[model samples]
Target: MLVLAFASSVENAVQRQLGIAVSVEMLISAKTKVTSCMEYVLVWDMPIVQFGGGIYRRRHTRIFGDQGHASPTICAYSLTRNKE
Candidate 1:
């Protein structure tokens, strides 16, 4: 996938610059429907390092509402491991 390729490139860059081992992964995350009125929801599990310590983790989710709404497609990437 293109996202995975990008993550790999990023990993290469990080290793080249900082000399730290980092791992990146991508996956489709299922999300629970909050209300019955909602429809066509897409979610992605995107984790990014917030701070420079121990691979800070965060989740990124993108939601698409009902019809006639402009839905945005999002790709998520996460760092599974970090060797500092």
Candidate 2:
């Protein structure tokens, strides 16, 4: 599944940004860089980065399991706010 999140300081700037909860310690453990935009993160591993095509740096989008047999479409859940 795909998950979209930002650092502990940003908010939902767009419509349809589904919010979820994540602990600060958990986020730190997972190792994430700054993310000002979710658009940039989702396309990090596509054939575009070689051309210097993103605003924020992130780890490559992970495609888990045997990619050859994995589903073409990913199920995505999103968002977690530091406060209400």
Give the TM-scores of the predictions, in the order they appear. Answer: 0.21, 0.15
Give per-residue CA lDDT, model 1, range 1-84, as digits (tens). 221212333234234322223355545446954434312323332333434555433433134322212213331212222222
Q: Best by lDDT, which number? A: 1
Query: Best by TM-score, which number?
Result: 1
Q: Which pairs of residues collide in model 1?
A: none
Name the 10 consecutive residues with the lowest summed lDDT in model 2.
39-48
Model 1, TM vs. native? 0.21
Report, for every candidate in turn, its global Cα lDDT versus the true structure: 0.31, 0.28
State candidate 2's TM-score: 0.15
**Candidate 2 residue-wise lDDT, 1-84, digit = tens:** 343433222122221234444332223334667554232112112211222543332232353321112222332221222223
